[model samples]
Target: MNTKPSSNRRLLAYALVYKYRIIAAILILCCAVVAELGGPYIIKTIIDGHLSLDEGDMTPVLALLGGYLGLLVLAGAANFSQSYLLQSTSLQIIKNMRMDLMRHVQRIPIRYFDNTPIGQIVSRIANDTEAIRDLFMSFMATFIVSILQLAGIYTALFILDYRLALFCLILPPIFVLIMYVHLKYSKGYITIMRARLSDMNATINESIAVMPIVQAFRREKKTLEEFEVLNEDRYVNQVKQFRVFSLSSRNAVGTIGALVTAMVVWYFGGNALDGAIRFGVFYIFIDYLGRIFNPIIGIFDQLTNAQRAFVAADKVFGIMDMEGVEVEDASSAKRPEGAVKFDNVSFGYKDGENVLKGISFEARKGETVALVGHTGSGKSSIMNLLLGFYEPGEGAITIDGRNVANTSKQELRKHMGIVLQDPFLFAGDIKFNVSLYNERISPEQVKQALRDVGASTFVEQLPGGYDEPVVERGSTLSAGQRQLISFARALAFDPAILILDEATASIDSETEGLIQRALKVVSEGRTTFVIAHRLSTIREADQILVLHRGEIVERGNHDTLMALGGRYYKMYQLQKGERVAV
Candidate 1:
């Protein structure tokens, strides 16, 4: 019944992806540890065998120096090889994990994004993944090297003297206890610290994205205060975390090292006082003990990073574990005829509260259906269902007499295109944004689509023409220009179903005229749905549905609605300053 893998298990699973390289690196490190340990014993041998004597053979001492130097060379070479292997392997794992998180994010439903801040998602990808890389590089590497170093040192100690070596075996359990106590005290701080960091990131990103509005409304100080609160919270938690870290890591390790050193000196010095311990043997035990704690200190130093990485791992993997919409490729058989219908459909973003109630309408091929409604009147909800953005709570939506729900969302959207009130553009050339790098849309189509939507007038005057470098979100372009590019983008795909949601609400009259002309041409042989507040643009629509309070109160052509003198009549008159219907 346990669906979630523990953090340890998850890390082991990802590490196994490069098991071969990790294994090879660990093996090389073990060899290096043994080779490095050999030098101390050799030094001890030379001291007791030759240096301590009144006279000794010079040839034997010379031979021992050569052997000691060779062990150092071997250790140096092995250390370099293992370091290179571990670093490269760790980098690749993190790279793959970051990429995987990004890809999964695309398949996540719109609902998750609606509730989650974009900054949190971004922090997970950019910052959290970077922390995980440290887990493998510093934590895993140091821990592994420490284990090998301890084994070599203890092996050397037992050879020198068994009783002291057995006493040293207790070091592992003591370090484990220190780490446990540190985690018990500091885990709360780390969790809160990371959450605050994510909150800060989200707040900063949101503020930067809406900076123009913030500055226009003179809310910069307020925004800064909001960011400052999150930053301060993070700082407080981090200080607390470091407080625990400072006590548990180097200080504890150093204290343990000093205690061990005192005991060994006492034991060995007592025997030396009795003239039973050799100078060389006594020196080697001290040397081996120092060697042991050097690695112990190193391993302990990475504990804080290791804990942060564990929390970061939970975040990165949690996203990957979210059940994303399965990627279903569009059907390739034929283009749709674009006959769309909503049959008594009811829907809501929240259960038991329908935003769209009992909506039923049909638009045959080549018909222009205009949806007119005040804010929150379910006009956009109808389009959302038709485009497979959300499912209808009750009843079904169909295209060409077949239920749309039977097909995958990708398949349903293949023949559809939509332009929102606020159009978005990416950081790319004008042509690239139009085609969106779809190979099916050629250079010829990009030019013609621009011409069709009247974007060419301004585009041709730019230095790069279609290749003009657009900054982030096309901030450099005019509102009308961005809308027109989005229009061209929709048209270049030449979709069978086109929905324009308040597409002309922000444009100047001249730009609206260009779009109207483009709409006249593009609506032929396609099912076009327009959600508009500007009633004049929908005058020639084949059908006009006026919605109020999640229900269509009136339905007819613009002329018929005017003649009926209903809600549509009153709304139109209000916009045009007409006292009565014309």
Candidate 2:
């Protein structure tokens, strides 16, 4: 009847993957507890059995002392072995969990990224996962050892004298009640703490990314004020959580443990003075009572970490549960020959709000189709649909008569490429950026593609030439150089369809002229779709569709649209500085 996993179930499942190692660690922990517990009883033997005897032979006492020393050594060895095993196993489990998160992020819908912050995603993978590492390494390991120690000590106490042990039993219930109170209070504080921490990370990532703009606009004080608010909120919650933790864990254990110890000693010691019980039994009672509170304290101490791990794992599982496009090894449909058609397609990023309404258009094989529209005219949305980044809500899209919705997204994108206005380049050399580490694209292809896109003029002049290392986002290169590299990256694939999404808008006119020449060569045998802001750039396009709002108002070549004296003509005249006010 219950469909959701238990609170600790996700953590346990990951640990179960390395059950053999964890079992070995737990077994070693038990050995350590037994060795450690035996020491107090051995001292009881020394005190009441040998040393208390009048005709004492120091020989047996020395032997008992030697035996106690050996137990101490054994406990030490077992403790080390168990710690090592658990730490290694914890690292391994965390590794697998992080890998799962990473792989899942790759498959999750791009819409999720569009909505989520980059730094918050990074926190989930980096910070939240590190906190989970503590669950296995410290919390669970401490919990298991503490439970075994408490069980062993209690069993020893009962054997010594059940009457005295009964008083110690009271500590467990009171400790449980304390933890219940602590959990009731601490969970809320910790939740706020985690959320604030994630928000801080997001803010920091954003601030660093836009530091240049912030300084240019003199917004440093405002940025710092914003970050300080999140930081202070996290600090407040953490202090509150720590207060709850302190009240429940060590302090509560100490107070209740002292009261229980006093009760057992008053009753049992009075009985001993009256000769009602042996001093040996009394000594053993004192010994085992000393051992009881540690495990209880340990349990309470780890509850904080347990709650955090639960929250973080829930966040992680939430991401994994979302629907994603399943990748296939091969596409069922044959490779398209670049005949892209949008048939009455309607789509929106949000529900009940269409961004592209009833958009019907086609670009036949090897023909150039340009989408001309003002800002927010839904040009990029069309490209997103064609590339299968999104699907139309109300209509069908087909490439070479193969329904794109039915094709695997990976396969559908395999033979298509795009160059954006602000091109993104990874931290790699010119060759690697072009090839994108695809083995099918050889070093020769990387060079040829760069040369074809006219990127070689600047690239060859650099000290490292094609092997020149690129920093993050290619900030080391000029704007035109980066754009040229993006164009070459598209050409390196030799795609059946190429999209230029305002690709030349950000670069200088001299570089634009070079790309225009290169475009003539590359567009010879591919279906080229250009989403352009500069009307002059699309003048030679085979066909142009001018869009207003979410619908096409004019569709024709540049000259035909000029003769129509419509929106496209007015936009073109405005660009050329000819007084043609619509």
Candidate 3:
């Protein structure tokens, strides 16, 4: 929401990258303008000379034509140089803009990501930034050229006939007013159109990602209908925008045409004007006048698009304006003693209705704690807080007696590793996905990590071993295989504390056995927190915490909690009964 203004001054900050090249482009443009004016002057000379019918001056007429042709060729070459400079400048700006946006995104807090839509973010990076770049590259030079041409024409007309030049000035003000109304009304519609298009894009993205579920449930028709609704909204907005554009364009050009027609008739009607203005001179004046007004109208039209471009840039800069994750230390902070303590911690998504309340607990320097509860019982919320994904509304969390809020998230997370229910794997080779391009770890270390997680056998069985492409989100690999790769990634870090959030819940019994064994070796002598649906997995935990409605209702080791006959005992009994039935 805190978007920055796309100030001309701000855009000028990029001059450091393309200043010299742009200067060359400007010089080319100047040469082209000189040629443009010079060619028309030569035509005026040829026309006047022929009207006089002076045989002695025929050679001068031929020389004027030759000079005009030469100037035209010069203009063509200058135009090519201008085009080359503009393209190179635009590409360079786009490269730097993307890099800046990416770096800004990296620093934004995780909470911003949770609240923002993936499609909107995609639009900012791909669509919005591109819109800005195109607006710059296409309009900036044309706008400058139009201004120069208009200024030159005005001066030429004044020098030729001051009375007609004054008349021409009157029509531009009226045209400007019409364009102002068009731009003011249609700018808002442009924003709406862009937003609707983004919504449609998001819908398409979601549908494609969930195509399997949609097909399995036979909801294709419903999805199509929804898409139709979105597309209709976009069409209506676009229509409105185009209609305003058309009316404004016609009003500006038609008014100028009528004015030009009246001026020609008025000038010729009087003997004083007809005696002075020649047919050739009049024709040239009309041609130059049309050229002048056409670009003026175009500038007005482009102003509307420019407004839309600014709105998009605002959205992009807004994301960049958000508070970045604070970095506590420049040098990597040394690992703390992995002693976690939650003292009177309470937190909620909004401001009220706490999801974690007055919870007090500790996982010693080298211990395993399992949080078990039914859905919406704050198990995941606690884990989220531990990872600093969200801050507590009341009280504090400490690692080795230092409050988490005081330390940088980057520093805090260096000593911690998390293996979620679904581990993310980028599209790359197996080795690259695991190492994530961190050069500190070697290929041999990657192999050892995979072997430690029991993933080496299947990985080697693949066609290219470590070189095999994982595909998007590692879909080429099975769920169990993906989990093993995640485990390998976590183990390779050699973290002091590991957070396992429903890690083995989705796997089969055989795969779970393999994972559980690997987890034992990896988790030993390290503080670990496990959230599990299966009661059997935490039977050997140093302590077990049972949550109920944001409060810890029961706490003990596996046997003690079962002996106490509380929430944990009830959950254990339910699982045991289900196992017996199976």
lDDT of each: 0.89, 0.88, 0.82
* Alpha carbon deviation, residue 185, candidate 1 (Å): 1.2
What TM-score, over all chains together, does every model reach?
0.96, 0.95, 0.92
Error of 1 at 279 (Å): 1.7
Point out where model 3 deviates above 4 Å.
Answer: 1-24, 50-58, 250-255, 258-262, 269-274, 278-280, 326-331, 578-582
lDDT winner:
1
Least accurate 10 contiguous residues by lDDT in model 1:
49-58
Evaluated with TM-score, which candidate comes out highest? 1
Residue 309 of model 2: what lDDT?
Answer: 83
lDDT of 3 by residue, 172-248 (tens): 67776877798788988888888887788788888988899999999999999999998998899889988888877
Clashing pairs in 2: none
| Residue-level error in angstroms, candidate 3, position 521 | 1.5
Models ranked on lDDT: 1, 2, 3
**Is candidate 2 or 3 superior in TM-score?**
2
Query: For residues 1-582, could you state the per-residue lDDT of candidate 2 as single tens digits?
Result: 858786478778899999999899989999999899889888887666545434655777778889999999999999999999999999999999999888888888889999999999998999889889888888888888888888899888888888777867777788788888998998899888889988999999998988899999999999999999999999999999999898778998898888778887887898987889888889878877877877787788789988898777877777766777676665354556899899999999999999999999889999999998889999999999998888789989999898988888888888898999999999878888899999789999889888887889899999999999999889999988999999999999888999999999998898888889889999988999999998888889999999988898899898899999999888988898899854
